[model samples]
Target: MDPSRVVLFKSLSKTLSPALGIGWIVAPPRWTQQLHRADQVDAQPSALDQLAFAELLESGAYDRHLRSCRQRYRLRRDTLVQALAKQLPDAPVSGVAAGLHLILRLPTAVDTRAVVTAAAARSLRVADLATYHATDDHADHGLVLGYGNLADSAVIEAVRHLRDAVEECG
Candidate 1:
């Protein structure tokens, strides 16, 4: 649900008479009645606005909007992967799906904190895997490359810088 839906629900409940909420497993007849009552009282947005909001929410608004974003991220991630593969082919890459970041595990001997500090020195933001887990020992040294907040050019450059940082440590 959108923020507006939440606000409208609150406003409607406050302004109108309070009623018991139907349980999740309500019968079809009672469910329809509840929906009808809600329609009478709910502060609904315009149909067109609602449609647009839904499109935006699902990331299926238009080809151009979705395509450009997908393409840009794909390229950025490719750049990061290529650089890492070239620099450290033995290091594994994981969790490169829908999320903003991809994980790259470094050599077991590498210091994860040192990688974080070096990336920071290069003006790159990254999360060391140790930050997410309790024990740093036996865990791989790596960085999570976040592509969502970064621009395409920035991502390419950042990945290049990352490659350099990793090479420097190695």
Candidate 2:
């Protein structure tokens, strides 16, 4: 954890919108110089976007928006967690405390792909946690449920669909 060697990179893509495509980096003086030189050849974000982001920051709109987003996401996460606990009691739901998604860990006998396929057939999209692993040996059987943008009713319905899908797979 050397401070000088560490570089912090952040973007408005996640907090604001991906369409904005504006980001910044913080690094030591040497690295900053190198990055500045590289920026000359690399594609940079549009000046209009940069100015808009600056305006948002200066006006405190960005902070207000972020606070609202955090509150909304927290409520969504809680709803999802409660629905999963009630609908899929046997399965352990993890990663609900933070982030935009929750991980539902299935029993070893349960096939993650089958559940994913079944859910997809019901118009419910879910990510397989195994696909995120670097190697097959380290993979785990689980589903990544993103509830950030989903309403409370949608969260409940999605979990019910997931539960039904898992039962169908079993």
Candidate 3:
């Protein structure tokens, strides 16, 4: 890969706090001028915010926070995975290695919208995987299950209801 063709966009909002309002772009030297010009009106973080974040980094607090977040999210993710596996053993799940969300790919014979509707009827919540895609060309038949804010105790019950919904809609 050519270095000139690579550009990286990074933000701490998701990892840390969105209120910090800081992000950056790394592009080849020549491309930077154009990118800067195009986003001349973009908001910049305050000097105090920058100093505070730098202190968090320098004091190792940020790293500690990241470790804590990872442990917490990992446990939640594992709970959801286990529930899904036990309740829907044949469902194909992905993104288990990392992240706060996972994708449960349904069988081709399953009607995604019907499943969503049925889940809603059962007071279970699930999203159609296609809703996240820009177009049908790249969409998959599945559900996007997010466990970021789900209570650990409720995971199994949720999966049980989800399984019932899928079975009802399939």
Candidate 4:
């Protein structure tokens, strides 16, 4: 790929905080200059956010924080996976190796919407897999569960509740 044809976009919002909304672009000077000119009419990220981000980078705190986040999320993911494996042995899970969420596939006869409703009644939040699709509206029924903000200690209980919900609805 030609360097001139490629531009990289980076954002601190994803790694840092969404409220910060600090981001930058990497491109050839000509492209950058055009962006710079357009930028004059567009709003920029807050100076305070920029300064805070810079300080975190300069002090190496950003890297440390990211590493800490990775470890915490990994543990949470593992805990969720283990609990689900033991609790919902028949419900196949996927996309667990990365990201904050994973998919729990249900039986073909199970009603995905009903499961979502049942889970909500049990105080467990989950999404129907079909909603993520653009069409068919009838294939690959499952739940999209996020373990990101779930407490490590509560993982087992959550899975248990989810199992009850699945069994009840499925």
Candidate 5:
């Protein structure tokens, strides 16, 4: 490896480690042999085989993959937020950051179970936030809508149905 390239790579790795909360740096494999050695594989795994993928995760290969996946998810999350704000501005949505899910705080009268039931009746599935969080007095009831699997049209329709469910409950 060129000394200049190594220095540059180390500098960038140092910068990203703090941002990512990673304390250690691992060098990228330049050869298939190096990758196999890093993963501690004595033999190659076939395409149809499920090998020690978890062991290779310690090599930071999984984290590298996750970083790319996270970038895509962030874009989707932004689009979802934009759609929700345009469609249901009155609804309380939270956690518009990098994550697989976000919370929508529905009106107090909006029974989350009823909303889920209504959504299911319409051939949709959603989760209630209250079920996961501990709330004795049943504070703002809502659903924890995840955009990981939801298409843009489905999210829009689900939000619309959610608004209707709240209105119907009231």
Candidate 6:
């Protein structure tokens, strides 16, 4: 990858709280200029929010919070994986190990939408993997399960609900 052509953007919304509405970007000089022009037409984050973020970073609080988040997510991810294995062995779960969410691939004959709907009825929110695709033709049958904000017991319980939903819908 050419660094000159690359732009990296990150937001505190994911790692920190969404309420912060803070983020940063690194881009080529030309891209930066264009982005600055665009920013003039768009609303920017509040000055207070930016100052709070700066203080958090300067005080080393951000790093400490990130370490805690990573540890929590790791435990949640492992718990979700184990629960899925025990509760829904037939469905294969796959994704990068470090993320807040994972994808559970259903059998080809299964209707992912129906499963999602059923899961919702049971108060367990799940996303159809196909919805993330740009086109229906490229979509696959699966569920996107996020465990980042859930407790260990909640993750297991969610997976159990998912298993029941699959059984009812599959």
Evaluate all candidate structures by whole-model CA lDDT and list the values in order. Answer: 0.66, 0.86, 0.87, 0.87, 0.64, 0.86
Question: Candidate 1 on 32-75: residue-level lDDT in tens?
Answer: 56666666645545566546545765775545655776787788
Model 4 whole-model lDDT (C-alpha atoms): 0.87
lDDT of 2 by residue, 82-113 (tens): 88889988889988776898899998788899
Alpha-carbon shift of residue 139 in model 5 (angstroms): 2.3
Score residue 6 of candidate 1 by CA lDDT.
32
Better of 2 and 3 by TM-score: 2
Provide the lowest-lDDT 10-residue window in model 6: 36-45
The list of candidate 5 runs beyond 4 A from truth reads 1-64
Q: Give the TM-score of candidate 6.
A: 0.85
- Rank the models by lDDT, top first: 3, 4, 2, 6, 1, 5
| Angstrom error at residue 48, model 5 | 9.7
- Residue-wise C-alpha lDDT for candidate 6, range 1-170, written one tens digit per residue: 67799989899888777787788888888787789877753667789989988999999999999999888788788888888999988888999474788999998788899999999999998999999998879746899988766776688778888899999987
lDDT of 5 by residue, 59-109 (tens): 887678668767767777877777777766767688776367888777666
In model 1, the runs with Cα more than 4 Å from the true position are 1-64, 134-138
Supply candidate 5's per-residue lDDT for 44.
Answer: 38
Residue pairs clashing in model 3 are none
Clashes of 5: 0
| 57: Cα error in model 3, Å | 1.0
lDDT of 3 at 11: 81
Please list the residue runs of candidate 4 whose C-alpha ends up more than 4 Å from where it truly belongs after superposition.
1-4, 28-30, 40-42
Question: Estimated TM-score per prediction?
Answer: 0.59, 0.90, 0.79, 0.89, 0.56, 0.85
Ranked by TM-score from best down, the candidates are 2, 4, 6, 3, 1, 5
**Clash list (residue pairs), candidate 5:** none
